[model samples]
Target: MNNIATTLFLGKGYRVKKQVRKGNELRVYIEYEGKQRCPRCGSENLVKNGKDTKWRKKLHMSFGFFRVYLLFKRQRYKCKDCGKAFSQVIPILRKKERFTSFFKQAVIFWLIFFPFDLLSLLLGVSRRTLLKIAEEFISRVMIEELKDKERLVIGMDAHRFHRKDFALLLVELLSSLPFGLIQDKKKAFMDFLLSLPPRVREKIDEVVMDMTVRYRRAVEEILPHAKVVCDPFHLISYMNHQLMEEKRVIEVVKKRKIPGRVLRLGKEK
Candidate 1:
């Protein structure tokens, strides 16, 4: 329509207007501008040769059934001075892509911020794709933020999602990054820990975990300098349970106060 309309379409966003039907042909009105120069070659000698219209059925703004009016204005070019003749390109959306890049980015952002399964169901994508996107995003962030000298504490443990008993996780405490996941077995956990480079292992300061004897053995064998702190939460839970049992025993002794009970209690003490 105008330069301002084209600029607005380039800046914020654009949507389909309508599809016009004339006699035996269909013409679609899209919020797009006339063809311009190639971004890389900077050529301006171009003309509109033909147009292709595609009917895309998409959910319209949450609660409506509508079709997308996509008019691909193919351009022809003649640049005898530069000895080049090419077609003017539309660079905003890629060819064969069902959705725009901006729309894909919005979907990715939603997946990163929200829960994966929920967002996948809402956006009509697979959970595997959601997880792959999240993992790639996390890997990029970690690569940017992780420093050579930063202290990294990796906690290794087995986690079970369901009936499968063998699921191991290596979680980096400082960066909150997942190092690796393997089958919940000693050999798998040992291999993962051993696979870390010397420099990375040296950066580790402490590893806090539950009182698993196998884990303690592995830590002592592998990380000599790193402090293995028995998780305070688990320790406190165990101590509280022991104290309750002791309190029950004392209450029983006090309730029966027989001479034989006292002597037996003294002997047990």
Candidate 2:
């Protein structure tokens, strides 16, 4: 059972000592698989001091519909080489954390498509916790992924989600993945582009955006080598507006000529 648990869920370097099931909740007692080594000195010459009797419960990925928790009693060891005492680190959970890495990742994945309130109820976690997980995950992803791009085709656009507020979104055109969002202001948009490294800015060859004069100016100033292309939607909207204005003028002229033509025909008859 320990071997199977280690292979399936608990991962290597952990052995399941015991398991208790109460309805849909599962409590698994786990410990390190090998001899306890001193973290400070990395030596096996250590004496058992005592057990950390604190209540440590780690929330893990669910098994089907059942909630799983890993309960562990951390072992304290006194190192002879370093003359210090330290507790064994749990590989599955970070220090001072209640959830496993895998569980946090799962929550982030669900949050991408589901509302926070709905996900919170489904996962039995508080809404605040779900939001924190998402924020940290997105921050890490953006820092790691966006900075290292060698070449890019970016797109910028503004959207109004509310009546009086607007947001500017920046996306990688090739992948259609959003990288940044800020208030729909010229300064905000310029600052966001300027925040990137010079190498990254140089690698941007093309930017697609609407015919906003501010957007065009900012891109030209920051990315001197990049070409800016106007999106088709803006062009079509402009053409439609001009055509409507011409049609109104033509209708007024025809209405004015019709009265004169009727009067002349009446006089001649």
Candidate 3:
């Protein structure tokens, strides 16, 4: 039971001290059985400080539809060599954190299928914690090397988050991956494009975007080799606007509002 628990969830160099099951919930009490040394100075000489009264409950993956949580209190210590205070470095966990690394991984995995609130309720985690975990994971992903840099079908669009605020998102259409985010402005977008390598810019096959005149002009000037295509939603919207404008002009001439491209039977009525 002990060995299985360690290998499965507690992680190596950590031991399961005690375990309990209540209804569908499983709680495993854990302790770090690894080396006791200062992280900064690597000294074995240390003084033990007090620990938290409440056990830190970190949610791991579900087992057979049963919620699993690893409960443990971090052991605080003061290093004699460097005079620095730190906690026992828990394996499968980052330094001094209340939650395990696996907990964050579980949050990220479930987030793909379920929305934040729903996942939070399912995992017994708070929505705020899920958001924090997502932010942490995304920041880590930003620094990693990108793959398939050449074969990219890119899409750029501005997302309005507030009444007056907007953000530009650059998504790889083929892979369905979002790679870049910047302020929604011409200069910000231009700066981002200019920052990319010329070789990469030249290799980009196409850029699909909404029919923004300035955006169209910028892409043409910067990536002249790459083909630019307007997305269908914006194209339809543009045609509808043109039809409305034409109808308004006709109404002024005849003094009546016509019913509504309002595309009828595969052709404009």
Rank by TM-score, descending?
3, 2, 1
lDDT of 3 by residue, 1-269 (tens): 67857555665577788889989887888877777889899899999987878888866666435877788888989998899898777767665565678777877888789876577678776665765676456434641323446576789888653456666778778777776666688987787788775665766789999999998898888888889999998899998898778778877887866667343233433
Q: What is the lDDT of residue 40 in candidate 3?
A: 92
**Top-TM-score candidate index:** 3
Stretches of candidate 2 above 4 Å error?
3-8, 34-46, 62-66, 150-269
Instruction: Identify the superior model by TM-score, candidate 1 or candidate 2.
Output: 2
TM-scores of the models, in the given order? 0.41, 0.54, 0.57
Among these predictions, the greatest lDDT belongs to: 2
**Model 1 lDDT per residue over 96-181, tens place:** 54544444455557755666456756666555554444444444455344446479886666654235444555678876877565
In model 1, the runs with Cα more than 4 Å from the true position are 1-149, 156-158, 164-166, 247-269
TM-score, predicted candidate 1 vs. hidden true structure:
0.41
What lDDT score belongs to each candidate, Candidate 1 first?
A: 0.56, 0.75, 0.74
Q: Rank the candidates by lDDT, best first.
A: 2, 3, 1
> Cα lDDT for residue 127, model 2?
63
What TM-score number comes out for model 3?
0.57
